[model samples]
Target: MEYTLDMAVLAILIAFCVNIVLCPVFIPFLTKIKFGQNIREDGPNSHLKKAGTPTMGGIIIIISFIISSFFFLQDNFEAKLVVFSTLGFGLIGFLDDYIKVVQKRNLGLRAYQKIILQFAVSIAMIYFIVQYGDYEKMHIPFTDKMLDLGGLYIPFLLFIIIGTANAVNLTDGLDGLASGVTALVSTFFIFVSWAVGSGTLPVAGAATGSLLGFLLFNAHPAKVFMGDTGSLALGGFVVSMAIILKLPLFLPIIGLIYVVEVLSVIIQVGYFKATKGKRFFRMAPIHHHFELKGMEETRIVTLFYVITAILCLVGYLGTAGIF
Candidate 1:
């Protein structure tokens, strides 16, 4: 069957409805099972009250998107690759969240263990892309140029997968922050994928719709958190679709918020050590810095949303060779 705009729209609506219906059932069940959030004591003071809000809400997005997207994956190998890549990373995240919330392990997966798992998943994705796809050349944004990695494609793609996934994870600090920002980014992907006649449109559409539905509960004064489960899976979903669409380079433009979030942490860490315990921002991730600087969480999140939308337009222009 030929894919159309209507099919994409239907996919979005299906995922949205599924997620909307699932949240009420999932949140209370999580609460009953004591799968609550643990606010970092070193973080913002206001967030302490968010403690005990049900966590691991990413499962809702995963289930919703997969169910809605399954129809479009009938014979599309690329779409299957994107969807399963998302599920793979989501399983890793689920494991982490399970360790922390269920087993009461405050640190969740150890640093080395998490890295090993992420590496394994990323490698698996690269192997599939190499064996089954033409993903060697990356489009340079705002130009009609393709940079082929050739022998280095494996490492380059690996970095894109791991870096983007973790960058998105860092952006999950505030309620509605990661989910809202990612929803906008995925919507941009839907448009671009449609413009290019890419098969990944359904995955992007499902992501956009599922995240928007998730926002109803994730917005400021959130009823629950997506935790690492949602954030990492979102990262995986975002990067995988980009890779499949051959638009990986557009990430820094469309995902600028995630880049900044990761940079803030890096700058904060590097500066703190260099200054002999002095700090750069009042906090890392920059969102918490603004929170410390007296910005309301809702306002900051809204600002990020608007910025992401604008960046998406810029990304579209670049992708279309209009800029």
Candidate 2:
């Protein structure tokens, strides 16, 4: 089926408008419900004032996307699958967030517990795609050739799901960071989804619309944080698209910022352990380092967005053979 540019634009506009209307209305409600973020003591001093900000605002985006999907995507199998996978991951994140909020602790679920749950959800998603989705071959970006993973596909799928989810989670340290980057990433996926001509393109389109909508309130001095709830769900949704469309390999290119953030944290921690407290940057995560280097928050975010847009364009051109 052909997807018109008009439909894509309309979906994005609708989702954006809905999010703008809902964030203000819902943020206060979230606070009243005691869904506040538990700020870590070790975080940047500037974030102390943001301690009581409402969290799990991702629920608003999730609900909006689900509703929008129903209204805009009818009988689209790929869209339905993407929605299901997103909700599944979101449910796990919601539980983790609930634990943090209820316990009034900065840490939520135990590491093993979170890993086990994420593994279960990812494995299930992989199985479903392998059994029900089209295209058994994985396409390498910028090339027409595809790789058939055969029995090894599950491991690769698991890696993509868990990696993307954690990458976004790690990137969520600052206000509006995760939401802004996610919106940009989703915008690219919308194009990829459409270009691939997979049945799930509408789902990607709907998700893109919803994320853009969420970003209106999710930008700087965020009234409500997307929390683990939104980041995990969005990450899962993106990975699901890659899996369904066999574009998992493209994540490192399109989501370069997230990749860099996750890598910085890993390198910093590892280096510190090896050197008995030697530091890698002013702070972990490349963005926070830039902040510490005296870059303005808006400028840093804009720069990251610009880089993401460029990488996204590369991914598109690579996939569409425009290079």
TM agreement with the true structure for every prediction:
0.97, 0.93
Segments in model 1 whose C-alpha atoms lie over 4 Å from true places: none
| Model 2 pairs whose backbones collide | 16-213
- The alpha-carbon lDDT assigned to residue 134 of candidate 2 equals 70
Question: Which lDDT value does model 2 have at 49?
Answer: 85
> Candidate 1's error at 227, in angstroms?
0.7
Q: Write the per-residue lDDT of candidate 1 for residues 29-83, one digit (tens) a residue.
A: 9999999998889999999999999999999989998998998998887788888
Candidate 1 colliding pairs: none
lDDT of 2 by residue, 1-323 (tens): 67655566666766667777888889889889888777767656667888878999889889877766675567676777788888988988888898889776567888999999999888888777778777568778899878888887777778878999889878887767887787777777777666656666566666777777777777787778888888889888878887777787788998999899989999999989999989898788878788778887788888888898899889887786421
Predicted structure with the largest lDDT when compared to the true one: 1
Worst 10 residues of 1 by lDDT: 314-323
